[model samples]
Target chain A: MTNNTEGRSAFISGGSRGIGKAIAIGLAKSGSNIAINYTRDKEAAQETVAEIEALGKIAKAYQGNVADFEDCQRMVNSALNDLGEISILINNAGVASRGSLITDTNPEEIRKVIGIHVFGTHNLCHLLVPQMRAAERGDVIMISSVATESLSGRGAPYNMAKSAQEAIAFTLAKEEKVHDIRVNIVGPGLVETDMGKRLVKATRGVEDIRELDKGSPFQRVCQPEDIADAVVFFCSEDAAYVTGQRLYVNGGSF
Target chain B: MGELDGRKALVTGGSRGIGRAIVRRLASEGADVVINYHSNQKAAEEIASEVRKLGKKAEIIMADVSDQSEAERLATESITALGSIDILVNNAGIGATAVGRPHVATASPDDFYRLMAAHAFASHDLCRMIVPQMRESTRGDVVMISSIAAQSFGPTGGTYAAAKAAMEAVAYSLAKEERGNNIHVNIVAPGLIETDMAEMMVKFQGRVKDSINELAADSPFGRLGYPEDIAGSVAFLCSERASYITNQRITVAGS
Candidate 1:
C-alpha cells in the first residue's frame, strides 16, 4: 500500500505493450524509474517511455531479444547505464506457442516459446540479480500464465514453457532470499490482450474478446491492468514478507 | 486517504498477536473494524480504542467461534456493528500445543474434532452467514490466515494440519463460487511467526532450549517473522489493489 518502489529503478522486458506496458506504467506510477525492454515495435516502446516520463519518472527503451543471452547482457548493461541500479525485474516478455500437440508441433516453435518464457527469464535474472544483491532490496516478478495450471491438450509448448518458468520462479525465490531478492509469479487467465485476441480468434473463432465475457467471472475478461495490479502489490512493501508465491489473477477461474 | 476507506472488516481473534496486528493494519488503512475475541476483554477493548483513535469505528464482540452457535452470533453481531462485512479475516484458532501435538497413532478423536471445529468449521460458518450480504456490496474480500503446516504436514501436527487444510478447501471453493459477485478469497500462510502461539509451541517442544530470538537466527530471514508481516498481506488482499487475485495462497515465509 505504500510507495515501496520510490527511488528505485525497474527493468521490464516486453514492456512496450499489453501486460508488460501496464506493469511498467504501474511501477512508474508507484514511484520507480523505468527501463523498458522490447523485442520489436520500437514506436510502441517509445510511447510507453513517454508515458512514464510524463509521470516525472525516468524512462528508457532498450531493444533486445530476451531469449538471446548476449542480447540480454547488452540490454542489462545499457539499462544499468541509463537507469542506474535496476532493482526490479519484470519478466513480462513472452511468445505464445501454436496450439498444437507436441508430436504435431514443429521443434522450432517449441524452442522459440520455451526460449522466450523460460530461458529469457533465466537470462535476465542471471544478469540483474548480482547488481540487485548490492542494493537495498530486489524484486523479480515472472508474468506467467494460467496454462501451467490448466495444462490443456494441444498447448504442450505453452504449458511446458510456463511450467518451467514457474519452476525457475519458485527456485529463485528460495535461492535469492538470502540476498534480499524476492521472487514471485503472477499468473493471469485469459486477458483481453492482443495475444488473447489472436488466441480466441484462432481457437474459439470469436472476433470480439468481450463476447466471452458472459461466460467469464464478473462477466468480464481479465485486463492487462488487472494483471499489473497484482505485480504492483508484489513489488510493494505490503508483500515484504511474501516470497516464493504464485498469485493467479484469473477471477478465481482456476 | 487510505485505500480501504469506507470499508468494514471483521477480524477474529483480533485481540492479540497476529489478529491484533491485522486489526491495527486494517484500521490504519481507514477501515472500520469489528474485533472478535473469545476472551481477554481488556485486550479487545484496548485494540478497539486504538482503532477509534485512528478516526475509524471500532467495536469488540465476544464469542468462541469454534462453537457453531457462537460463530453465528459473531457473524450477526459483526454485521450489526459494522453494517456489512466487506472484509472478513478468519484468524481465531489455537496453536498445535493447545490440542496436544501427538503422533497420528496416538492422536485423540476429540482433539481432531476440536481442531476442526475451531478452524475449518468456524470459517465455514462465518462465510455462509456473511457472504450473502457481501454479494450486494461493491466488493468483498475474505482472507484465511492459515499456516505453512497445512502444506508441510510435519510430524506430530496432523490434527492442526488437517484443520488448516480443510479451512483452505473452504476458501478455495468459496472463491470460485463468489467470483461472479466480485468477491475475492485468498489465503495467507505464515511460517513460524514471532507470536505468543509460536512461543507456546517452542516452550512445549522442549528441544529448543534457546530463546525465540536465538532460535530465529537460523530462519530464512535471520529473524522470525513479525505479526505485522502476516497482517500486511491480509490488508493487501482486502484492498482493491488485489481485486483480480483469488483462490490463491501466498506463503509469507521469506522463502
Candidate 2:
C-alpha cells in the first residue's frame, strides 16, 4: 500500500462483484481513484464505477480478459490512461470449477484455472512493477483460495493453481523488496457471493457449508467484506512495512 | 484534509513509551489532544509540550487509571475540556513487574490484581463513560492498547494476558452494542516492542539481543517495532481512513 492513497489510483480486476467490488468501494472511500476490469460485463462494470464515483472518487471501467498476458497489459495501460499511475493492483479476477478430480478434470478448465490465477497475476505485476518501482511504493494483492491449503477442494486444477500462486507471490515479494513494493496474498474461505451462491445451488443447500464454517470459532460464513477489509488493511499505512505476508482472512477457519 | 484534522483526541498514559508515541502521531495529524498520566507530571507535560509545538492544543492531567473512580474522573474532565472526545485510546496500563521474573509459587496476587485493574477494568470504565459521548456524536474511536501476551499466551504473563484478553472481549461487546452510532473500536497489540518493558523482558527472560534481532529480522517487516509502529494503528483508528472498521484487533507484530 502507498503511504498515502489520497491521489493514488487503484486498479482492481474482476471488481464488478464479490470481494473485489467491496474492495473497490473501500478504496474509493479511502479517497483513491479507481480503475476496474471486467470481461465484457459492461453493465456490472459500469455499476461498480457508479458506486466508486459515489464515494467522490474518479473511476473508469476497462474491458479486458485478465487471464491473457496481452490483455492484462492492455488493462494496465487503460488504467494508467484513466489515472496517470496505477498505484495499487488487486488481482482478484478468478474462476473456480466444480469439484473434479485431477484425472477427470477437463483440459479446458485446467487451462482456465492456470491462466487466470497464475498468468493473470504474473502479467499485471510484470507490467506494473516498473511504475511502482519508479514511485517507490506499491501493493499487489492476490485473491487466493482456501483450497490452496484446505481439505474441501475436489477441483485439483484450481487447488494446484492457487497453491502455485503463493509461490509466485513469495517470489515477487522477495524481488520487490528493493522497490518498497509489498506483495501479499489474501486466502479466503467460503464467502457469500455469486460464485459462492452458484456453488451452493450446485450443492443444493448451504447447510453443510454453514456447519463446516461454524466449526471455526467465529461461527459464521466468511463475508466478501471480510476479505475486502483485509485488503484495505494491507494497503493502509498500518501495513507500511508488512510484505511477503500471507494473511488468512478466513474467519478462524483453518 | 489531514486524516485527523480538527479531531478531538484523548490519550491515556501519554507520559511515556507507546502512549507518548501515540500523542506525537495524533498531534502530527492535526488533532487537539488531552494527555492523561497516572504519575510523572513532568513527563506528561513534556509530551504536551511537544504537541503544542505541533500547533495543536494539548493539556496534561494526573490520574491513576487503575482506580475505576479516577478513570471515570479522567473521562469526565477530558469531555469537558475537549468539548467532546472524537478519539479515545486506552493506553494507560501498568506491568505486574518491570522484570519478567518467571512465575513461581511467590507470584503476587495483589500485584496481579493491580495489573488487571489497571489495564482491563480501567479500560472498561473508560469505555462505559465515553460510549455515551461517542454514541451521541455518532463518531468516535476507542483504541485499546493490548499486547502480544494477549494473543501469544506469553509465559508468566497470567495477569497481563488475562487483562488483555478481557479487554478484547469488552471491546467487541462495546463495538457491537454501539455499531449504530458508527463508533469504531479496535485493539493494537504490539510484539517485541522497543520499549523499556521490552528491555526488561528481553533481559530477564535471558533473550539475547542477537536472537531478538534475528527474530525481528524474521518478521515480514524484518524488524522489531518502535512505539511509532503501534501508534500508527491507533492513529488509523481515529482517522477518516478507518470509518467502518470496528470490533477488531490489529497486531503490529513486525510482520
> How do all models score by TM-score?
0.98, 0.68
- lDDT score for candidate 1 against the true structure: 0.91
lDDT of 1 at B96: 82
- Name the candidate that leads on lDDT: 1
> lDDT tens digits, residues B1-255, model 2?
467887888899998989999999998988889999876899888989999998898988899988988998999999898888878899987663542443634567776677778888998898888778877674778888898788777568766787778888888787766655667777888777777667666666666653445446554545678888788778766665454456666776643
Q: Which interface RMSD does candidate 2 score? A: 6.3
TM-score (C-alpha) between model 2 and the true structure:
0.68
Candidate 1 off by > 4 Å: none
- Among these predictions, the greatest TM-score belongs to 1
Q: Which residue pairs of candidate 2 clash? A: none
Question: Model 1 over residues B117-142: C-alpha lDDT tens digits?
Answer: 99999999999999999998999999
Q: Which lDDT tens digits does candidate 1 get at residues A56-90?
A: 99999999999999999999999999889989999
DockQ in order: 0.72, 0.17
Clashing pairs in 1: none
